[model samples]
Target: MQHVPFPRSVRQKASLAFILVMLLAVGNVSIVQFLLREGDGVAATLNVAGKMRMLSQRMGLSALALHQYPGLPDLAPDQLPTLFDEAHDALRLGGRAFGLDIPAVPKALSPQLLDVRQAWMRQQLAVDALARAPAGDRVAVEALLRANTDLLARTETMMDSLVVQAREVQRRALYGAYALFALDLLLLGLVGWVVSRRILQPVQALARQCRALAVGDYAARSDLPPGDELGELGRALNDSAGRIERLLRDIEQEHAALADAQSMFNGLSDNTVAGIYMVDESLRFIHVNTRMADMLGYPQAVLADGFPLHQVFTGADYETVQAQAMERLSGRATRTRYECVARRGDGEPIELEIFGSLMSLHGRPALIGIMFDITERKRAEASARRAALVYAHTSEGMVVTDADGVIQDVNPAFTAVTGYSADDVVGQTMNVLSSGRHDEDFYRVMWARLQDTGRWSGDIHNRRKSGEEYVERLSINTSYNADGSVNCRIGLFSDVTEKRRREASIWHQAHHDHLTQLPNRQMFEENLRLSIEQARLGGTSFAVIFLDLDLFKDVNDTLGHEAGDQLLRLVGRRLTECVRSSDLVARLGGDEFTLLVRDIEDPDDIFPVADKILDSLSQPFALGQQTVQISASMGAAFHPRDGGSDSELLRAADLAMYAAKEQGRNHFRVYAAEMRESVQVRQGEFARGPDPASAPAQSG
Candidate 1:
């Protein structure tokens, strides 16, 4: 049989299609180039016209300034030269707009450009005359200003005309471009119709034939005419149908084998413990194993209903899965392994570790992911993490050591307390921090407790890396292994140096006067009692001296309390100096003070110390900017002679002090038996009437 020849091969038809597309692209480029050229010309003309108008206005203003003030200070020295240069540039640009020295301008703006040039020339001439005018020449200045104003007005009108022309040119260009576009679209539509008729129609017919053969219809034929590659394809399809018919029987046998293999694969997937799933391009699950269905708390039938991948995750988790999916699709990642909270069918959340990769499933792009339920594992991890965080962040310093007490590890608090880093102390013995304050017995006792009870706690003095000693409340525990042997030891401690110092400060503040730091009344009484006991035991006498500042209240009223406090501090220092180191000097409230003169030979021995105290206190004291003169009155009582107890001695000394005050201030008086009677009689006399002799002798 004779076969008809095809008119065109596939290569020829493809070449013709490419040529047509190239022609269309060339036409588009030509049109774009024409529009761009026209636009550039219009833009240049508009720019030149605008500059000319601005320069014209500037020259007019400059002319006015010269007319108003011709002084060199008022007008810039280069103002006239700059104006001339600007006028020249405007003229040049105006000429260039009409193709004088640059690209040709659009014809529409030619008349406007000519008018601008004339106005600019007139404006420049007027400005030149103004700049050259004499300072007092009012008539010339006025004439030049009028000319410049008229020229500027004309230049502005020309600029407006130029703008209108530019807009017209642009409108025309737009219309031309639109016309060209329409023509191009019409031609493209015609070409497309021809291509569809000659190429697509025949191709579609051949495709139907192939489709028919694919579905096991061997008799279908395209019946295409022999003129092009489509005709050749039609004949090829006929041949393919014959071959397909012959292969159908073999394919059926192979289909049986494939079905069996698929069944086996399904069986294996169902028996697997891990959940396996495949998602289509639309993120819908097209296949899921029995393990996956059960893992999601869903039946196999429900999973086969095309569940979406996004629905497997909760709201917050779905967003993360979507971001990972996008990253994989964009080729930034090939596989993703992440943990997310997945929702079961009953809306309960389960932690899942998803291991996914981009793959092709059933001829479509998809994700094949394996899901592992990690709810229990995650719970365990979270608990461990919380315990670790507490151990690391606790304020108590922690140290881990071997059974022999060699340092192994340290927490951040250890660094803060000991000023030693893990790198500095690791492998070093714990004794490295010992301040040498603890004896061998102390350590022996501590180790004995640790061995017997597996724990020890005490206040220990340890030196820091700076060689500074600090107290730490330390507790140590030994960890044991299965065989009851020591594994490691953990020590917990806190730096209590500041706490101890604060406690000491509080004790001092309580027992000592805040202003003068001398022993307060309570401490003085305690010391006096102890001294009385010692005096009685040793058969030695001690004196309890009471002293009062004369006119101290007057000093406080004259100056401020601050000055009065300074005076009291000075008096306290003098009193301290007057007493021996073994003696006790105390502030007994306000300006009164007392001293326990220990180991005195007799009551008279207290007289010299009293005199020294009075003399020291009588001296002038410099308080800031003022010199203050003050005195003290002293009274003494012997421990055994005056009284036996602290209260009795204090009372005797107080009475003697009042007697000394009555006789004269700045005087010392011993506790005489008659002094007590004298105080009582004086009190009775003062209650009655003033003594006639005691009354300040009438000044005359």
Candidate 2:
């Protein structure tokens, strides 16, 4: 049994009783003293009234003597004035004693005092006049006697009224003293009764109950009345007793429940997958389940020998665990979950995820935890992280689209190539990047191929964010669901616009002159062969004109190769202008050019083109500050009429050109079978080192 306790010390109750006793005694003494003081005041007032009466009678007697001894001057003056002054003093003293001019005087006494004072004043005045009159003046004496009579009668009445008031006051004081004594007796009796009932009896009952509680009788109660301090205390004691009793019952119930819980905990500890453990405030393992011991690779008996928490982890991990435990113990957190490497008894480290909470065990602060093995999960997460890194950082642009060809995601390289950020292209159709260069039929065919093969690889022309056109080498593959339906598409591509431009540049460099940008010898020969082949197939003859600049070497010797190059460029431009757009104009080596005219109706048509070449070269060329005039020696050969092969036609044109030069340069000549002899003689002269003065000059 248990019960509440009240702090009703015996010493405290005794002290309160003593204080009440002392208060009662002091009250009685005070009342007695007050009555005595009131009685003394009434007696003093009665004495003052008697003195006033005596003084007034004395004054009257003195006035009578003055009236009787009308001629006794000495006695009349001195005695009369002395008696009047004495009476006035006695009257004022009486007024003061009766509380006149003070708030204590009764309202009924005021007018009586005033009347006596007036009468006394009148008598004194009369007495003074008599004293001042002639010593034997009987009339003055009679008048003084009369005034003294009136004054005596009024003073007598006033004294009588005061004596009556004093007697009444004395009687009332006696009555009051009796009443106060009675009240003191009653109060003392009441105080004793109250102390006995309110304080003493209630306190005694509380003391008995306290004793009973100490002896384990929890059912004892004071049950005092309310509306007093003692009653409040009783109620408090009763409440405390009830709470204590309930607490004891709860302890008994909790003890039984704890026994049951311990049994259940042991059963679960042997079978549950998780390892459960408890550590005391000093970080020493106080309890470990069978599973916990097995998880740590320790025999249950050895672990039960109380291992320190530090032995279960590496040094750094133990330190971290200690810090976290301290935080929880200090109330920063109630529970926490964290990962740490735990060492087994065999000294092998194992990764674990621990869910821990702060709790009280056996009335001491402790930590309880449930640990799970997480090594495999951590390894898988690390592998996934590596794959994510590669996907994020690869250089090739990649885009993922849904089955409907709407973009779902893009990598950084995609933004770099297409200038469209993931924010711009996600959820947008793939057509957003299309250059609109491919017609519907082209896309229809492309989609057909894709659907059939599940892949497509080709060059695609696309538009960028800047509206600039670029080519990409794109390869796309389709992904399918388990049902073989298309799920999504992945595209990998690289911008090849620069690559295509570089390839074009290399081809141009192979076939064109670097200086004049005109077709060089290789291109000219190929075109000539094609023209000869066309003539044979169509049965129509075309013309090949061979032209050379006259005196061109003199210009190079006079100026420089740079100036010669400039002259050649101007010549090439003029020659291109002279030929029809359908014809081919090629620079066949230094200062020599060939024109291929196709679809010639007559052989005479070749002569006008040849004449135009000579005429254009005859114009002045501005080479730097020098305006130099130059001309060309032109020769024409009709294919089929001249030999059919490329070499045959080119030789015929060359021989005719030398014939024009031999005929004296800056003129055109058509090839004939007769010029063959002169061309042979000139070729023999050019091969033997012909003189510059005689040989034809090539144009600059």
Candidate 3:
């Protein structure tokens, strides 16, 4: 047979082209998004900063104009509007020459800049008042003008600072954009080279490995050959080659080993045992032994029928066996303990058990099957009753009970599980095993489910003869005789008391806060809803108090969050201690916590509890080796008085919570319905009012 190897370079060329195009597109997207877009953003900011600088220059020009045309004493009182108007009109034109938004820029700063402009207005008003006076008193007007000029200089300095900051931001952004563009180009070059290697390198290595295997090299395997189909072929070749090597070595040594091992099977087969003339797998001699030929009644000429195994076993069964063996061969993947069947001369079938693995054989997928006959052993097993003894029975527990729940057959394990033995309660009813906690209803339901479904599975709590209760995972099954009538009832039982206990513990841990082990927000809300229902049913005063750790975020950001969490846990412990054992203390997430103290005497009782909570958190917490002090701000709202509903009461408490935080931290405050107005009033009071149109009219 002749063989031709496939070329790796030709196979990888199309993939290489696709990879190159993707790399180019990626490089272009990186350029447009990171480089050109950033450059555009920097240019936009530069324009804004440039505009601010131009405004600053215009302000300087206005100051220069005031110096050039000073308010003169020589100018007549009636002609003063003309002088002021001329200066203002000329300054407006000069402002437009630059890109200054003169009206808007000064307004954004502190009112001191507007105050300087107002001082100039006051100066003009004084001048008008002096002109109307009996002898034109110009002294007050001169003092006002001098004061206005000093304020204008201060305003100019503030404007200069703003211009400097804007320009600096613009300058940095420009430099960063260019630097980023340069780095982008360098990364794009590196990526292109990487893409080239990624496309070509693997295919070349696969080619080298394939060529290494083609020349009778059995010790070879391939990683992949770029396609799933070809890669699978490569694996099959590797597996087949390995099997062939082992087969050849075994063939060379089989005669010597057979001489040593054949005595174990002497006289096992006779001429009439299988009713077939002697024939080997390849239609050769019956045995690589002399006595086996004597038993099978065959001469050497009769053994060699000169027929291929495939031609002898034809039809569906023939195709099935060959297909299974060839599939294992082609996968270079390994296998062992494989089974297939072959047809006998009398039309009877013989089953074969073969064990082999994949190996490379001159770059071809192949196999070496070692066949054995198991027909006699299989026949004896199927003809008799089947009993499977399972040795690893840790996960499976067995029990044998008679019709009346009497212990008939029991293993030593049953005594260890239920804490009962054969002599202790053998004749007793199943009720003696009950913990007596669940009523007769539980037993009735269990019986009903088993009767309806033929099986029932559930956890059962049972008492031992010594009166100790143990929980068990109980599965009850009803067995039937030949006619499908009931034969016996079997219950598989395993003690799961420890497992149930652990599950309960885990559920409690998840719902409760870790450090305080108090009911968390989720549990608190649930229990609170239940509490509210109880309160409504029985007329009682109850209150929900909300507590917050004051400036906790600042402490966490400045110090570490560990200190913050420790502080929160400490607060939780203190809150629990302060309330009654019957009351609830819950830690909400972060620095917030809540106390549900029911059966209160009055709303006033909440104040003392809130005060205690505040005091408790105010005290230092022992965190690690360090004693760190943090405090709480408490806000409280009462049920029925503050809110009839749970959500309403919580909201009221939360609103008051922000109030406590606002009024310097570390204090308890009761909910005031009008507190919202107070905050709004303060915001309005802090804001500037409209300038009133007043008594004096000034020059333009």
Candidate 4:
């Protein structure tokens, strides 16, 4: 009754061909749209499912917190259920939720989704009951915990099932696309063959008859049947055999115009900066313009003769390039751009950037490619990378600042040395690190020198983030713009605080006594000289006292040198505590010490200092477990009355020391004129035998 529909005329067959093409296009589009929807829907559903699991856990934690601590506010008890319901609806049906376009649950995963929904309902009920329960409600907390655990388990199962179903759908879609493509290709080939036989053959016959008529054989005819468009065309051609000469003249002029257009196109292609070439579906070179031939160090004629692709692209990227060409021919992609390495004619490797597209050339599939040589650009990139590596790893702190000293960038080493991170210092001025140890004049002179010489380097004092002052050896270089104005300043520095500290330590060790940690004779003599100069200039007076421990040698002999050294250290500390901070204390040698008391207003001031020294020395000292009592003989001399110079004052003090020893073992004497005479008078007796009264003796 329907009268099977079949194409019986040329017009019907042509319409059939167009319908097949439209069907193939529509089928491909439908498959693509379905795949995209399936992918997006699976992702959105999985996201919502995962959130439900997390929400279950969150509710349990909040409930536990409320139970453990009384008077605690509920954490999202009211809003959480509402959110859960919305997400649940979005997942079960299809809608936009939580910023995601969710699709309805798949038929295959419907059972798992239903199970999750039921479990979540139970968990929701438990959460509501817990919210109303009192503090320390162990029963309510435990019930919610159990419900949430079950809900979480079901959610995980639903997600697993979702993933499995999504994979299956994608797999089926891929197979369907392959089968559909094969069917479309078969249909296209069959349509083409049918058209060639039913339409092209008739047209060719008409063309031949016309050609015969143009050459004066007017008896020719196409001999085609009537009724369809092709049959009508053949009949018309047979009737117009007499007019073939005029048609032939018009076709010749059209051919001439096409030749001129092609010549102009070739001329522009050869003159372009980029290399232009074309390749057939088999990847054999179909055309090579002059620029392309010159770029590859090959003759255009050689490439156009179908040079092998392997020889043209001799690099590890050959396979990738081949894959791109195949994708283009297979209708997977229409255009592509990529970088690859190629060999020049001299076998030297070069980098190239290529832009390619699929095109029809002479009614056959081909690829048109444009190439640019990027070897120099790649080399410059590598150099920049090496420089960046150095800047990051170098130990020296580096900072770049604008002409006005606003900080722009800093390296990691800068953070290490300054104790300031990039976030703390960037966009700030260099004064952030100022220690305020230098005056404005100091900076003014520094900038003056930099502006004159374009460089400045010195030891600078800077403060750390922790408010500690440190010294750094800093060097700053100035960069100028083309107009000779300052562009930027680059500073490189190293923290030299520890290095300078070590230097000071070495100086102290050289000038101080190692045994007692006091100023040694060298530093003591220097201080005395300095004091003498100050006293003379100010018309003031100072006292010098030379002291000797009476029983020091005996302690050394009885308790060994170690014990004597311990006693000396204790004596030094006590002597320091007894004197003014302005006074100087020194250990001259074994059993001998000196003191310089400056700015004495009256001569009597020296006596109290001498007495305090004697009293401090007389106190009992603990050596190991043994206590020993010792006395000292001290002698004092005044500045102008005793001597005007360091050498004379020291001699007077020495003379008075012996006089104190001659007077008694534990006494201090001011230097009188007779002390020096008394020392001379007893010189022969001190040489003959030691004076028992002044001699060293052990004190119990």
lDDT of 3 by residue, 82-161 (tens): 43333233232322213322222322444533443455465455544444444333464454345445545544554454
Structural similarity to truth (TM-score) of each candidate? 0.35, 0.39, 0.33, 0.39
What is the C-alpha local distance difference test score of candidate 3?
0.59
TM-score of candidate 2 on Cα atoms, chains taken together: 0.39
Off by over 4 Å in 2: 1-391, 400-409, 426-431, 434-461, 468-471, 476-490, 526-543, 580-582, 598-605, 637-645, 669-678, 681-700
lDDT of 1 by residue, 1-700 (tens): 1385322765666666677778878888998898887677657655655555565566577667766776534332445445444444544443343332334444554565565556556666766776677776777677766766776676676567656766887898889889878888887786686577668888889888878877879978888777677887788888788777668767977898899888866776777577887776666777788888888998876676788868787588999988887777666888999988888998988888988888876666778777888898888999999978978999999999998889999999999999999999999999989999999999999989988999999889999999999999999999999999999999999998898889989988888988889998878878887888787789999888888788787778787788888888988898899888998898866777888888888566777788788888989999999999988887888979999988778878877887898888798888888886777533321111336754311100
- lDDT tens digits, residues 467-508, model 4? 999999999999999999999999999999999899879988
Question: What digit string (tens of lDDT, one per residue) describes model 2 on residues 1-700?
Answer: 1374322444554566677678868877887687676666556545655655566666656655655676544333345445444444444443343232211335576677677678767777887787678766878877777776786677677667766777787778778778867876886676677567667898899899889889877767888876567777888888888888889889988998898898877776766588888878888777778778878998876666677888888688998888888988887988999989999998888898988899998888889888887778899899989966766898889999987789999989899989999999999987999999988988787788888998989988999999999999999899999999999999999999999899989988888877778888888888888888777889988888888888788787787888888998998899889877989888866787888888998888877777777888998999999888888888888889878788777777878888898888798888888887766633431122356785433432
Question: For residue 6, what is the lDDT in candidate 3?
Answer: 29
What value of lDDT does candidate 4 attain over all alpha carbons? 0.83
- For every candidate in turn, the CA RMSD to the true structure comes to 35.9, 20.4, 49.3, 41.3
Clashing pairs in 2: 549-698, 549-699, 550-697, 550-698, 550-699, 551-697, 551-698, 552-698, 552-699
- Candidate 1 has an lDDT of 0.77
Tally clashes: model 1.
Answer: 0
